[model samples]
Target: MKQLVILAGGKGTRLKDRLGDLPKPMIPIAGKPLLQHQIELAGAHGFGEVLLFVHHRADLIQEHFGQGSRFALPIRYITEKEPLGTAGAVLAGFDQLADRFVVMYGDTMMNVDLTRLWSAHEQSGADATLFLHPNNHPLDSDLVETNAEGWVTTFHNRPHAAGQFFRNLVNAGLYVIEKCALEPWSHDRKLMDFGKDLFPALLNRNAKLFGYNSPEFIKDIGTPDRYDWVCAQYEAGIVQRSSLATPQRVVFLDRDGTLVKEVSAQGLHRIEDLELLPGVSAAVHELNQTGLRAVMITNQPVVAKGFCTEEELQQIHNKLETLLGREHAFLDRIYYCPHHPEKGFPGERPELKIECKCRKPEPGMVLEAQRDLNIDLANSWFIGDTTTDVQTARNAGVKSILVRTGHGGADRKHDVAPDFVFESLPEAVQFIAARSTETSGE
Candidate 1:
């Protein structure tokens, strides 16, 4: 049986006033200590044994949960005479740490699937898998940049540059790490942190560090305002829906007019012609960070018209991916329609000229992606610049947003009527991020 390690050794300096004599983990939340909530959640997720690393007022915690027989969740403690930072505490418990174990901060009340997180860690074959989520305030929070495969490439702590926009993925203070990954620093016996010290060293060695971006609610009630908000969320039962109970949300985007500047009258036949519009990279990167899958659904009839071959189309996509990668952005998947109904062009290819279901206005690409990604259409949103795009969302039973960047101005009067209209892709993304906490039915 794997162990769940809870770091309950913090002094709670910021919360000292309200929680006078009590440790941060023992602070009451919804009529129970925060540690109790964490224990119950772990037990519910099949974690029968919990290893708590405690320092401040350790005796109080040990006496309260004695042997854990009452709750059926056995408890063990690793008392530290002096304060050990997050990672240091784990080293102290090195003898008992399992081959693979979970590490979570005791200050947070989060509703996540430990089972799924464990599964992700096992499948990734990574040294560590950090729990990442999009916080309301990205600019002021520590951000993480990841590739399309969810590998953590960079870590940007708070107090970033003076005026720089960044993706909103924040470390939620939960992790699944392998015991062998700590061998290098196990003998130090000094204060060390996962973020400030260990993670940076691992990144320098090109370690396999992945990020599990989850939409599940995870909040640290460190300040008074945040505490009140968490209490309100619990009272409203929003916490329950934020669990694995709800489906993941997706943002389906259009390629030409929406993501990049559309070509004049000619089709995109060369990679040099691909230019990402203003803020498109940042917007897509934000989607990547927000735990929302950013998928590209475009209609590329140039292949059937003989303007470009399928290989050339692939080259164009490669250019787009390279551009986005340069800005720390990536698309989860790209789906394009290469067929056209009317083929009278001089160099048209008959094999690729057949009418297909994947073209815009037909929900073929969206439906196929939904089937493959297990997406919930009702909770997803489609953003495009043409009337066909709006109609496609309607056909797929998902919400649609028409942007003014591409052909949006002329397509606004379409009969299908978009759910919302924005001036650009960034505006649409802003709207979606702001409403990320809203409840979804399907």
Candidate 2:
């Protein structure tokens, strides 16, 4: 069994009102100590042993768990005489740690699949893997900028009030680290933090730092209000849903008019004709950071009309991904309908000329995606520039947003009312992200 380390030494002054002399890990949640929940989650995920780095109120933690026998896993403690920052405390117990071990903050209330995370780390062969997620409060959280491959390109801690807007993928205070990654700075005397100090150093050296972006519930109960919110989530079983097992919130997007500049009028058949609209890359990048699945749902009748072959259509999509990759934006998957109901063209394929359920204004694509992606329809949204897109969303039982960019605004004269209207993808993303915060009460 791999070893696990819990950094429980912080003073947790922000939570002093509820903690008193006890540490934040000792704070009771749903009739059990918070630390107990973490330990049990670890044990279930194949971490059979735990090492707790304690400083403030170490005796309370030790007395409560007592070698972890009652918890069904052996637990050990390492008391830090001085305040060693995040990385320093872990390095202090260097000898006991395995070549690869898991480290998580004691204050987090997250139920991640440790086995899956560890497997990802082992398969990637990276120096370290940080558990990253899209949080509602990216304004004050440490943000991570990654490429399409999920490799950390840059790490930024809490930026200044006037800093430029960034992606919402923040560090979730959980990681898998190799002992070799920290050996270089083990002898340093100064404070060593993971986000502010160690991670930046690793980036500067161009070390491989991968990020595992998960949608599992993970939050820091630093303040009193946040503590209440976490407890409520636990009671509602929100924290219990693992990313692999739970339904996801997705943003269904139309391809031509919504995501890129529509070229059907000019008959776009070549890869050179496919160009991403302004701010489209950043918009999709923000969606990626928010952990929302961006699935391209489009109606491509060009294939049925013989304007382009299926292979050519794929090349067009490949070009879209390649262009977005330059901006560090990526889409999870793409689904297109190659059939057209009416076909009077000279070279039209009769078989594909029939009306299909997967076409827009029908719900087949959304329904198929729902089955394949485990999408939560109520929490999902559809962004497009046509009445057909809005009708598709309505038929699929999800909210809809009509953009004014492509065929939206005056061009669309339909009785179907969208939930909201925005100028473009960027404006639509802002509305969705802000609405998520309001509903989450973050």
**What is the lDDT for 303 in model 1?**
89
Q: 441, model 2: CA deviation in Å?
A: 19
**Candidate 2 CA-lDDT value:** 0.82
Q: What C-alpha lDDT do the candidate models reach, one value each?
A: 0.82, 0.82
Residue-level lDDT of model 2, residues 303-422, one tens digit each, is: 888888887887687567656655767676578898998868978888899878999889999998886557899999999999989989999999999998888845454568899999
Instruction: Looking at model 1, report the run of 10 residues with the lowest lDDT sum.
Output: 433-442
Q: Write the per-residue lDDT of candidate 1 for residues 311-361, one digit (tens) a residue.
A: 778768856765675576777667899988996899998998787888888
User: How big is the positional error of residue 313 in model 1, measured in Å on the Cα after superposition?
Assistant: 17
Report backbone clashes per prediction: 0, 0
Residue pairs in clash, model 2: none
Error of 1 at 304 (Å): 15
Model 1 error, position 32 (Å):
2.2
TM-score for each predicted model, relative to the true structure: 0.70, 0.66
Off by over 4 Å in 2: 161-163, 249-442
